[model samples]
Structures are given as structure tokens and as C-alpha cells.
Target: MTVNSVLVLGGGFTGLTSAIALALRGVENVTLVERAPAWARVGHGITVQGNALKVFQDIGVVDEILRRGFGADGVTLFHADGSVMMRLQTPKTGGEDLPATLGALRADVHEILVERALELGVKFRLGTQVVSFENHGDSVSVLLSDGTTEFWDLMIAADGIKSSTRPKLGITAERASSGLGIWRGVTNRLPEMTGGIAYPAPGDEGAYKVGYTAISATQCYVFVLCEPQRTPNDLPDWQEMKRLMEPFHGEFDWLRESLNESTYLNFQEIEWIFVEEPWHRGRVIALGEAVHAVPPLIAQGAAQCVEDALLIADYVTREGDLEAHLTEFQERRIPRIKGVVDASLQLAYWECHPGSPDAQPGRVMAQALAELVAAP
Candidate 1:
């Protein structure tokens, strides 16, 4: 089946990428509806891994991302006392030319996507949501919160992990929490901090980690993992975040000093969901966090989402059966997603249980990076 019109739910990386990919492939009438009135992302800074950068390159935005973001080659691991543990070069999963990792403000990346989508004539409806949807034999009819019903050749759920569209499509995947929350913010960058720097400090709770990466010439993103909680808790303030950074030394001392009452900080509770096989039913499908989400252990979430969008755009635009195309997409993606999710979970386990004999994050990371270097 040939798709002529598409409805994309959510305006995040997945939704925008889907809309842009489809539009770039000459799919007309691609409408992306976002629940937020304006673009908003909690984490101010984002790590654009090489694989995701490769997708951005394909979609014609990598140059802008690289220009606006800070590019780095490796990550330095340090102990709580600021002593070096190990440092290694990260794989350039995107290719030889692109940086292994690029850091930029989340808003900057979102703005770039929005501009590109608009340039491609992708329609955007902000402060809108899908109230309901029904999948027919060949098309999906959606009811928007604006009280309008529209039909499309295809509908994509990219609304994120807590997607309302998942249940509507009969996907039984539930959101899973890692039982940990993270405090993150952007601060002035230090000249010597070239690449990603991580500090794994042992605490009364466990071996939670903290780190910072340069987001720009003058700014870097800082983050610290909090103690696991029995349930979701309230948002943490900058003072609380400072207290969490107290154990950290070296660059963290500067990071802590950078925090104040005026500084804007954001707290994120780690949650994930992995939708099972049959990512689609009829003409409606789910991608990105709506289908799979992992902890930030490996930072592969965005890349996986981009891969999903690229594959969907490629297969859906091709001639033949839509169901077969979707099935093929799922088949191609499941193994990769499984590797990322499982390895990330292992890393998360290591963080929560410091001395567990089963926690081999190094082995897991090496194996995962090796597997991910190949084309998606």
C-alpha cells in the first residue's frame, strides 16, 4: 500500500523525524500534532551519539547539529575522589568523519528539526492531542482533541513512553521505572573538559554516577543519579542537587559552585517501556519511546528512535503490502533494540547494586558498542 497522507502523534524526536522523513520522501499531507503548546524538553542538554548524527546527516540536519553542538571523541571515567579510573575513545558509530558524540542543548536540536520540517512543508498542530483513533482495513481514523476527525493512510504513535495511543492499538507494554531519579542542568564549561567525564562514587545507597559533557563552547551539561526510591517522588531543587554533588570532586566542585537559586535545574525520574512484537496493527503503528525506552546508561535511545523513523519511511513508501513492510521493519529493529535495552538494564543494575557479581557493565558496554557500530 502507498501512503499519501500521514498523522503523527507527538512532536518529539520520533514524531518530527517521522514527519520529516516522510516529507523528504515526497509523502504529502504529513500532519504532526503535539500535546504541548510549545516545544519543551526537560533535560536541557542532549548527547547526539554518532549513530543518531548519521541519521541526522541523512535527513539533512547533521551539519547544523555539528555546527551548533560540541563534538567530543572519548569519555573519561573517574573515581569519587576525582582520580582517573579509565579513559577510552568511543566508537564513531555514525562513520569515520563524524564525532563519536555531539552535545547540544535539547532545545537547539528540537528547533533545528522544527525548522527543517517546516521547510519540507510538514504541518504542525501544537497544543493538540489524539482523543481517539480507530484502525480500519486500510486506513486509520483519528479524533483530535480539537474536535475534528480525520482519516489518514497511516498513523504513527510517537507520543513517548506514557503514550495513550499504545493501549488504543492493543499494545500491552507498560511503563517501567528504574526506581531512580536524576538531577540535571547546564553550567559553564571548563576549558580542559573536552569530552564526557563521569564520576562513579560509592554512597550509602549504592554506586550512583554523575558526569558532565560540553554542550557548547561555554556550557556543559551536568547530571547526577539519586538514590533509588520505592516510588516516584517530588521534583528536586537546586539545593538538593548540590547536596547530591557534594561527594563529587574535581570538575564537579566547579559544577556545584555554578548552582544557585537563580540556576534552572530539572529532575527526571527514569522510566521505560518496551513494546513487544507486532509494533503495528492494521495501519496504525508505534515507534520511539512509545515502543521502546531504555535508561540513559548507553545513550542509545535517540539513535534507536531515529532508526525506527528512517526504516518506517523507507518501507512504508515502497510498493507492496503495508503489513509486510511493518513486519519487516519490526524484524529488522527488534534485535538491535533488544541489545540496547538489555545492556542498558544491565548497566542500571550495576549502578543500583554496586558489588553484584553479575554486574559487568564494562563487558556489556564493549559488546554493545561493537554490535551497534554496524549499520541499522
Candidate 2:
């Protein structure tokens, strides 16, 4: 049965992408509800991997993304002093036609996605969410925060790791902390900072890793991954961040010096959650971060989320057996989602425990990427 009306919870990457894909596929009525009154445009840069770029291409936004973001050929791992440790030619998971990675500010990416979704006639309501939902045999009835009741053929939950709709479906999944925190900010892009660069060595303040990537022609994003067990109840001052990053040389010095009160800095503890199978019950389904949220160690979180959106759009627009299609969606996505979540967790574990014998980040990353290269 073709779903004529769909309600999408959350307006992040997953929801927005799903709305765009569904509208493009000719769904008559698609509405996206976001809890936030306005877009959260404040965030550090993000690396949109090649696999994710494929989804953007499918949805017809790849050219705009490339225009607004910086494309890089490969990644380089550097020693503490900025000396080269290893150079890797990353696989073009999207295709040979796309770069291995594209870095863009979070605000830019969000705007692009929202613009595309709006252009396709996907309705959006801000500062509103699902108050409750009742899934009847064939359709789902949703009670929204706006004191309105709407009946839709399907409901999709992309409401982040702590999804309120999960409990309505009797799914109990809780996000677990990675015991690590990160500091991120943007600054002027140095001429030599051509691609993604990482420093794996420990810094002065027990920072496990430091990395930076160009997000635009003249700007870059920087991050410092600190050791776990530190409470981040308050945002640290620029001096504290600068002190923590003082151990490295080269571009680190530049980044360290670039810190100021004007810099848009942010800090947060990393957390993840992976829900078990049966992602759908009745006519409601969960996808993206709501089902599987992982750390960005391997940069597959957005890619997987976009994949889920594309698949959901494909399945829900079909002309037969909704339950079977939902089941098939979970079946097809489980292997890939499991691989990404496991690899990301392993990488987080390795970072938290530096010398664990079981840590093989490179191998895990390679295996995960190999699996993701195939069409979802």
C-alpha cells in the first residue's frame, strides 16, 4: 500500500533527508516536526564522507554541497610535533567522481538540507513534537505538542538518541556515555592545512587526540578529544582550552593561538546508543540516530543516517505490504548499521584505553568502509 501521508519526527539530518527523499518520490503529504523553535546552526565543522555524498547526489544536492564545502583527497596522521606519522589514500566510497571527504560547517549543511527539503513541499512545524502516538492496525494516530491530533499512514522517529517515541513503541534503549569529551571551534584556514589532519599523541592536559580540517576556502574546524572521567557541567574558558592544547607545535600552535572570546567554541560529552531489531511496530518505524547513535570516530554517523533516510523513503513509497517492507528495511540495514556501530565503539574504546591489545582501529575502519562502499 502506498503511504499518502507521513509524519516525520525530528528535523535533523535523518528527518530532513527523509522528508526530502519522500517528497521527491512523490509522497502526497509529508510533514516534519522539530522540537527546536529555530535551527541549531551553531556547531563545528563536519566531515561528510563519500558514502554520504552518494545520498546527497541521489537527492540532487551534491553540487551545492561541494560549492559550499571544502573537498579533500585523503587524510594524514601526524605526530605531536606535526611530523607525518602515516598518509592514507581513503577509498572513494560514494564513487570515483566524488572526493574521499567533504568538510562543511554544520550550519551550512543544515541550511542546504532544509532548503532542499522545503523546496520539495515538505511541511515543517518548529517547536512541536509528538506528545503521544497510537498505532492502529493500518495507520498511526499521532498526538502532537500543538494540541492537535493527526492521522497518518506512517510515523518515522528520527528524534536523536533519547527518542520519546521509542517508549510509545515499547522499545527500551538508553544511550551510554563514551567517558570522553571534546572541544571544538573554527578558525582561519592555513594555506598548508589542505586536508584532514590528526594528531594521535597525548597532549599536555591528557588530551587523547587533536584534529583539524578545512570546512571552507578560508576557514577550518579544530577539535581536541580529552580523556574520560571529567565532568563537563560548565563550558571551559578560552584560556583553559588554550592551556590544554599547548603541548603541540606547528599548526597546533596556530590553532592554540587562535583561541579567543570571539571563537565559537563548544564542549560536550560523547554518548552513543544502539537499539536492537524490530525497528518498527505497527505503522511506526525508527531510523537514524534514534536507533543507532555512535561516536564520530570513523565519521560514519551521518552517512549511516542518510542511508537510513534513503532506504526509508524507498520502502515507504512502495505499493505493497507495509509490514513486510518495514521488516525488510530492518533486515537490509542491520548488517551495515551493526558494522558501523561496532567499529565506532571499538575506536572509542581504543582511545579511552590507549594500550589495549585488542585495539585495531585501522583494521576496523577499513572493514567498515569496505562494507559501506556497496549500495544501501
* Candidate 1 residue runs with Cα over 4 Å from true position: 40-43, 200-207, 229-236
Which runs of model 2 end up more than 4 angstroms from their true locations?
200-205, 229-235
The lDDT, on a scale of 0 to 1, for candidate 2 is 0.85
Specify the poorest-scoring 10-residue window by lDDT in model 1.
Answer: 227-236
Residue 237, model 2: lDDT of 61
Q: Candidate 1 residues 53-82, lDDT tens each?
A: 999999999999999999998888877777
lDDT of 2 by residue, 77-182 (tens): 7777878877777778898899888989988988999999889999999999899888888889899988999999999999988888777677887888987888
**lDDT value, candidate 1, whole model:** 0.85
TM-score of candidate 2 versus the correct structure, residues matched by position: 0.95
